[model samples]
Target: MQRVRVSSQQAAVHKLGDSQMTLSPKFRLPAARSTITDHALDFDNSLTGEPLIPGFPDDVALQCLLRVPVDQHTSCKSVCKRWYSLFGSKERFFTLRKVLGFHDPWLFVFAYHKCTGKIEWKVLDLTHLSWHTIPAMPCKDKVCPQGFRCVSIPHEGALFVCGGVVSDVDCPLNLVLKYEARKNRWTVMKKMVTARSFFASGVINGMIYVAGGNSTDLYELDSCEMMDPKNGSWSPVSNMRTHMASYDSAVLDGKFLVTEGWFWPFYVVPRGQIYDPMTDNWENMPAGLREGWTGSSVVIHGNLFVVTEHERTKLKVYDSGNDCWEVVEGPPLPENICKPFRVNCWESRVYVVGRNLHVAVGYVVENYEIATGGNGKKGGRFCVRWETVDAPGSLFDLTPSSAQVLFA
Candidate 1:
């Protein structure tokens, strides 16, 4: 096992360098939906302050251009220098799209070269169900990463990759790579105060929270850290309740919930905790909910959903109010199929990527209840419906994270 270590300087934000926050004047006022079709902004790109497009008004032209699908954005960018500058600005493009109600959700899967083992990310367009390539992660030797952890910032078109192993030698790194959805590129971000692997991370309210990973040995560290994207700086988060590695994590009710691990044990023991940013403190997780969070999890409709690690046969949800695991009983997996290679959830839908790159999108068919024998009462049950499609290729082994859903 690889381990890394860094000191926890609480209540302190590291000043690595100057912030990379860039602002342009053109994107200042967002175009209102009421005037999306009727009018256009008078912003000028020419030397004499003339509107960008020759025939139509600039805002009207931009409104039409923004309606173009994201896959065709690069083609639009190549028309002229002004077009390139307008489309290339991640903030402007996404902002205009949001104003026009054209926000689309996509699934990002980080897969590796089947033969060479070179790691890269693929974007699955949920609208069209097509596969597309994203920019390669900036890793050492431009090869696959080690001890890597990724968290998606959905509102903004970006994903963050923190601390990964640099090479086969297990030389741990403190690198943070940021991926911009609009730009289709990856750029390095400010370093994490510490370099560690297998850490638990989540983004809440635009701030990135990371906790618990290894440092220098097999032991897990209790230290934590947070990053502010606005300033491109890293700050130390409050330490965890106990020094234990987290197997899976999800946010619930504005709190980051992490669970299922041990503190130097031979047998499996699930230790869980919750970190509330409002208070910047950790608390012990409830009993029943803590035990079964041993697999990949995502937050859907303000509830914690899990895809079991052993078989990925059934979908499970945790009812925090009652503190119990409720299984979504529907169709079982095919006899020939095994556990999924990756899983993610968005809104009411859950997506699973099978070993052969078979994609199954599951959603609740209807709401009903099963008759429980106790006290003449009924229990909650979900009838999940599945839709399957084949993606481009098979996933490589040693993937650190599963697929993530993003709205761009």
Candidate 2:
């Protein structure tokens, strides 16, 4: 692929081959079961002591302070030294955010309207079930010209968009954009190491990873790289074992799973590959995992759930413990949704926004072990429910290219 500058002000694009780091491949795959440590408990149990704010008593102060939303933590921190100490512990702060029911799921949908030849971002406040227009992306003509893949920083309520093709270019895009929900604005970030489209992406342990997509000349790339938000820079990583055009990605048990979206001749594709950032290695996935992951995939409570086919598709859960897939149902849903829709998993809750402006919110209530399922292979069973909400208005007829979830 030909290298191009992102812009005069953007960082120079880097390639995997340009770095001195060895691009070695190890075939070892981690256990299908993830061994990554769970997040630290979000709450501090020792908050019954003396008050940090001086005037208030400990118990009384705790009640009043917990009411403050997570987004306002920065300002609350500036109140005094003690407030910073209390809010500085991210785990405890998030725990409070969750415990007090302050964390609300926010959804972002990227729509490129061919009718007007423009791209606009719409954000839905799921808690209140309403939509708000966000700042326009910088990519001119058709933003995310080919198709955009969105990754979210739920804790910080920020979003990143990558991949997609531009109207004027023969190749896809390496341009990346960041959306800060607090400010409801979009800004260009460091360009990707490689220009590609339809790549696999996800956020694991807060790092953004992109792998396998269409490079120049219709080449399906086997390469991959990652971006560290802390430093606002990109670094090359080892490539995947196979050239995969990742259509769907999910983070389960601390590992990023990528599916080989499609293949020529026979349509059958395997379960795909799983990358363990801890070991910096990629391993082939177990067979049959791909079929279950046909469309959207999300992880809830350390368990994997996927929706294949269309809007009304039955939800399937992968029970890593039993090594079997299970069907789950909780709420009834419309038989079909707009052909182009999105499923986003935030804090285990799934939000589907699409067609154009329609939205559906869902959650998995429970999982059950099935006597038999999955092409005669016995699978587990689960329950899920989804309800649709009418968005404010339909700005265009264009389908949503990508969607993400955050809490703000």
| TM-score, every prediction | 0.74, 0.69
The TM-score obtained by model 2 is: 0.69
- Shift of residue 37 alpha carbon in model 2, Å: 36
Error of 1 at 5 (Å): 63
Candidate 2 lDDT over 145-249, as tens digits, reads: 435678889878788988777655656888888887655567888899888888889999899999998887778899989999876699988889999687788
Expressed as tens digits, the lDDT of each residue in 176-236 for candidate 1 is 9888786667888999998777778888888888888776564787988999987779999
Poorest stretch of ten by lDDT in candidate 2: 33-42
C-alpha local distance difference test of each model: 0.68, 0.67
Clash number for every model?
5, 11
